[model samples]
Target: MHLIKSNWKIALGVIPALLIYCIFSIIPIFISFYYSFMSWNGFSAMQYVGLANFKAILNDSVFWLSVRNNLIVVAASVFGQIPIALVLALLLNQKIKGAKFFRTIAFLPVVISTVVISLTWRLIFNVEQGLLNNLLDNLGLSALAQNWLGNPDYAMYAIAVVIIWQFVGLYFIIFLSALQTVPRDILEAADLDGATEWQKTRYVTLPSIWGVIIIAVILCISGSLKTFDLIYVMTGGGPANSTEVMATYMYTETFQGLRYGYGSAISVLIFVFSIVMIILANVLLKKRGNRKPV
Candidate 1:
């Protein structure tokens, strides 16, 4: 009777979630792969078309541009946001005056909706009367002022800046929490041993927070890959798909163009890319963990 009850409880907890996962994720993925081999309008019959979609994607100039733009975002997120956030985290962990207030203010942006951020930044970046340009003009730096969003060259960078601004705080918080767990004695010992600030950070602080760094890297990768709202609301992949990332491209392909089959193919592509990134991240993380002192 006890065994039967335990089995029933397990089934009850697991079955519903499994069923939901199948319906939402697993089944939809298989369907996308199936459809990628075909072409179909939403209301019409799908025509089987072999590797044509994949081949076409290989030659699609816009797709390549989108890929390049995404890579740029990924690079900027890693280089611009992560390291800076870690530095901020270290500062906040020092029991400085107003530390909690600064932490709260930093993280407030993350809680705000992306659409709102996009809209706000759009206005801020407005060419003529926008706050950013106006401030530059006021400071006698009008030569630096330009139409940030309208210019194809600067649009992608502008969006990336906004994304970094919003999300950096969360990583800062993660690093701060991880920093608190480092033993105080270790730091004090390093101070006593006449270790320089740079040396102590290099050996003690970094090694202690390595795991949190791994987690932050993974999060930044995923978040960058899936970036859509800022690109969408701010640029709409625009001026010419210059700032297009996979999420926005997939969305435009699927809904804006009403090419369900092509959209599904892009969806599958995104899934494959995300999986590869996750695997690569895990491999690097494991290597780091192995090298760190236990």
Candidate 2:
């Protein structure tokens, strides 16, 4: 009773936020789980369909295609974007003139709204009057000038490039902050030991910032998995759904196809995939951390 009384103010302070979270986040997730087991058209009535929605999703080809595209995005984000961000961060972390200006320019894309970025890239990628094709034509590289966002073979890659370009700044800032946290003493020690620049980075800088790298990887995975807005604005999963991802696929199923139950199942799968990937990443990183150095 004494403990409860002492914490009453804290409880009261938390109630509003707790209530909002339950109402906006928890309840919708529960509702989606319930709806996943039923056939609903968003109109007349929901019919209890048992595992029918799951069955349908299992056999969905386009759904699998979307999953493949999502995996591609995840790969590009973690492998392509994060490494480049790390390099930029390392360079910018040095005691160089105009470092702050370079950092600001690098992070500028992260502050821009995704919708605006998508629209800007869309114009740049336009085949005829756009900047890229015009540059190619002027350089006598007309053969390389093709419809970047329209060709099925290249559309997904094009979108992936835009995604990487737009968000590398975010991870760069994150890595830069991490790099700044590294102990200057350790770097000095490494220099005294005659460690080459590469040796210093590989042994001191990277290992010191491993935790931040892991967090960046997790962010890349989660963000890539749930990516929707940019793809929607840019491609709408177009050119025969070549650029489709899980979020866009779910939206298409629910709103466009009116397959509410199926879409709910897709949502549930997205939640599960995200959870599994996060867990696996944590486990792998933990194991790596626990390993004794040679």
Candidate 3:
């Protein structure tokens, strides 16, 4: 009774947010799941398709190719972005000169519009007059320059690079915050025990922020799965759809191809995949955390 009386205002505050979440997030997901079983262009009468879309998607080569591309993006994000972010976070967490300035510079890319970043990189990846090719020529390595975004073999990699560059800053900020929260006494004790900086980092710093790392891992996985805008603006899943990921492919199917039902199916799959990955990550992390000696 006392708790309710004291925290009633706080509980009231969440109602508005809960209402907004249900209206915008929860309702839309249910609608999409419902629509996944129906065939309906925006202007046409709906027809019940009843798993036909899922069956078709199973047989579709392009769909699987897009899934493969999404997996690549996920791998790049989990492996490439997380490690780079950790390094940047660790470096910036030091008591160095101009730390704030460097942190700001590192985080600047995350706040920029996706379209802007895509267009900026688009010029950089251009074959003939692009920054990359020009730099190669200036370095006398002209033979090394190739069409980064045009060739099917290289297009997905180019997109993955852009994706990693744009989002690493966000993860860096998360890691930096976690790093700052590590208790100073523990670090001092490690130093007194004659631990090197690398040893302290691996043993003390990382273990202290393991939960944050797991959360960041889950965020990276989910974000990589939903990648769309930059790839859309840069490649439009083009050069023969080599750069296709789930969200862009979903957009193409629904808005461009007008296969609303099939697109809904794809969206559902994306949601399912994201949930599964997050759950697996959480379970694995929790298990590992439990096994670790206090």
Candidate 4:
């Protein structure tokens, strides 16, 4: 009772925010959860079916393919996007000329509309006369020119590159923010100790921003699971479902195929997978942080 009275002001201040959260997030989540047990074609009456949809999803080959693609995208984001972003952040964190300008330029892609990038890359990857193929042909590398979107083997990878290019700037910004907080004293001490640049970075810089790394890993995992727009615009999960992430597959099932229950099952699976990854990442990060030099 005493604690509640003491914190009443703060609780009162949070009331509006709590209300907004309830309206926007909580309500919709509950609705989705409720709809998950039903079969509905958007405008039609919903038919409640217990775990049938989930069972069906478990047996779905294309669904599994979508899951596989999502995992691949997540792996690429974790390994490729973040490492490149960290490298860029490290470069920008140094006392280089026009570092701020370079940071802004790198981040410009993130702010640019995904639809625009999708359309632009779609043209670049065009089989007939796209710039990529055209350049390759001009340089006498015509043999390297192949159908990027039309081919099943290369389609997912191509989309993954686009995804990476589009969001690398976001991660770059995250890394830059973390890099900015590294203690100058530690760095100066390392320099005074005759530590090589790589040695200083490996020992000092990486340790300081571990929290950011963990957050980036979580974002990568969740973003990969929920990716929709760019892939929606680029391939529509096409080329024989080769590029079908769970998001795309779920969208197709719910809206196109009129399988709301099944779509919900996919969403649930994605939610579960994301939760598992986040928990695992947290464990790993905590262990790494504990093992850091005291």
Best by lDDT: 3
Please give, for residues 118-155, the per-residue lDDT of candidate 2 as tens digits: 99999999988989999999999999998999998988
TM-score of each: 0.90, 0.93, 0.96, 0.92
Give the distance in Å from residue 187's predicted Cα in candidate 1 to where it truly belongs: 2.2
Candidate 2 vs candidate 4, TM-score winner: 2
Which portions of model 3 miss their true places by more than 4 Å?
Answer: 290-294
Q: What residue runs in model 4 are displaced by over 4 Å at the alpha carbon?
A: 1-13, 43-45, 292-294
Q: How large an RMSD does model 1 have? A: 2.8
Task: Put down candidate 4 lDDT per residue, 66-132, tens digits, no spaces.
Answer: 9899888988888889999999999888899998899999999999998999999999999998999
Candidate 2: residue 289 lDDT (0-100): 64
Model 1 bad stretches (over 4 Å): 1-22, 284-294
Cα error of candidate 1 at position 198, Å: 2.8
- Worst lDDT window (10 residues) for model 2? 285-294
Return the TM-score for candidate 1, rounded to 2 decimals: 0.90
Q: Give the TM-score of candidate 4.
A: 0.92
Total clashes for model 3 = 0
Every candidate's lDDT: 0.87, 0.92, 0.93, 0.89
Q: Which candidate is the best by TM-score?
A: 3
Residue 1 shift from truth in candidate 2, angstroms:
14
